[model samples]
Target: MFVKNGNCNFFSQKLTFNTLVVPSQPIIAPVGSDVTLPCQLDPVKDLRDMMVGWVRHDLTPGYIHIRNNHLDFLIDQNSLYLGRTSVSESRLQQGDMSLSLTRVRVSDGGKYSYFKCP
Candidate 1:
C-alpha cells in the first residue's frame, strides 16, 4: 500500500500472509505543513528491531526515510528528503510503521512504497 500525499507522500508496506494497510484515499496536506502516511501490519507484530524503509519509485535509490533497530539511518537517502522524514519509534513495537514528513513540498507529491526486513 501507499499514501500519496498532496505534499509529503507517505509509504505503506507489503508482507506475505499478513498485509500492510493504509488509508483508502489520498492524503491531502498543504505545502509547508506536516503529513503522516498511515500504515500498519494486519496482525500487529513488533517492528522495533526490523528495518522499515520508505521509498519513492521515481527517484534514484528512492529511499526517503529508513529506520533500523529502532533508529534512523540517513545513509544513501535522497537529498530532497533530508531532515524531512521520520517514523514513530514508540509506535513501532505495536506494528505502526507510518512515516511522518515535515515541511511538505509540492515536489513531494507522489506515491510511495514501504518495505521491512523480517
Candidate 2:
C-alpha cells in the first residue's frame, strides 16, 4: 500500500517485491522549480545485482530515459531530456533514484516513474 505525505505532494510504498519492482509513487512538481522524484525499496537481503533507473513519461506516449546511475542519461536516444535531467547523488545510500529538473517547464509536468531490481 502507498502512504501519502502531509502536503499530498508525494507518496511512498513498501513490500516484498520480486524481480524488477515498480513501487508506488509518481512525483509531480511545478514548473520552474527543482524537484526530486524518489524511487526506493525495502532492502533486498543480497544486492549483488541490482539495477535502478528513473524515467519520464512522455506525453506523446513513450518512456524517455532521465538518468541511469552508471551510464548517466541515454542522451542519443533521449534528446528531450538531454540536458534537463539528472539523478540524485545520494541515491546509492539513500535508496532514492529521484531525478532533479532545474528551471522546470510546462513540459516537465507529467507522470514520473522509477524502477529497481535485485
Candidate 3:
C-alpha cells in the first residue's frame, strides 16, 4: 500500500505466504536527464491485476504513477511529474515496477517509494 501523510510517503505490503518486494538503492541523476527507480518482487508473481503506485517522498498527494486493471490512472498525479513518468505494461507480470522519469529536474531529487498491492 502507498500512504501519504504530511510530506512523507509510506510504502508497505502484506504477503499471503512468503514474498518480498525489493527496491533499488539510491539513484542519482543529472538535471534534464532520465532515471529509473527500480523495484521488483522476489519469487515473482503476475501483477497485472494488482495496484502499483509510485510517490516522491517530499510531495503531498504525490502519486507519480498508478497502474491498475491494465490502465494508468494519472488524474491524481503531481503536476511536476505530469507526462514524465511511466511503467512497462508488458513487464508488470514479470514483477518489474521500475519507474522511468524523463527530463529529471533538481526538484525531483529525493527518495521515491514504489508499492505493489493485490
Candidate 4:
C-alpha cells in the first residue's frame, strides 16, 4: 500500500492484510507536547476484533501500546508509556491506526512501528 495526498493505493493477494502508513518526513514535536504517529490499513476493514500494537525499537521492552478485542491491554506495555498512549476510538473503524502519545519527553524521539494482526 502507498499513500499520497491522503489517498491510499492498495495491492494484495489476501483479502485481509495490514498496511501501515508513516509520514514521508520525520515528525518533530516539542518536549512536553503531544504527537500522533500516523498509521493505517489499506483496503480499510473493521479492526474491532483485531490486535493492534505500537512499538519503538529504541525503547526497553519496545511496546508502547496494544489494542485487542476492542479494548486497550497494557500488561506488557513499557512502564514509561503506561499512562501516556492511546488510539482514537472514533477513527479506528475508518482504518486509522494512529497512536497518540501525550506529554512527550526528549527520550520519546525514535522510530515507531505499527502492527495489525488477525
Superposed Cα deviation of residue 104, candidate 2 (Å): 0.9
Query: Across residues 1-118, which tens digit of lDDT does each residue of candidate 4 receive?
Result: 4345546665545464556667899899999999998887786777777888899888788999999978998898999897999987767888888999999998888888888888
How many backbone clashes are present in model 3?
A: 0
Best by lDDT: 1
**Every candidate's lDDT:** 0.91, 0.54, 0.84, 0.84
Query: What TM-score against the true fold does each predicted structure earn?
Result: 0.83, 0.55, 0.79, 0.81
Model 1 weakest 10-residue run by lDDT: 10-19
Q: What's the true lDDT of residue 100 in model 1?
A: 96
Q: Where is model 2 more than 4 Å wrong at Cα?
A: 1-28, 44-49, 57-63, 66-69
Q: List the residue pairs that clash in candidate 2.
A: 32-104
The digit string of per-residue lDDT tens for model 1 on 1-118 reads 7788788888878645868999999999999999999999988889989999899999887999999997898888999999999999888888999999999999999999999997
Which residue pairs of candidate 3 clash? none
The global Cα lDDT (0 to 1) of model 2 is 0.54
Residue-by-residue lDDT tens digits, candidate 2, 82-115 = 5666665555555555556667777766666666
Off by over 4 Å in 3: 1-24
* lDDT-superior candidate, 1 or 4: 1
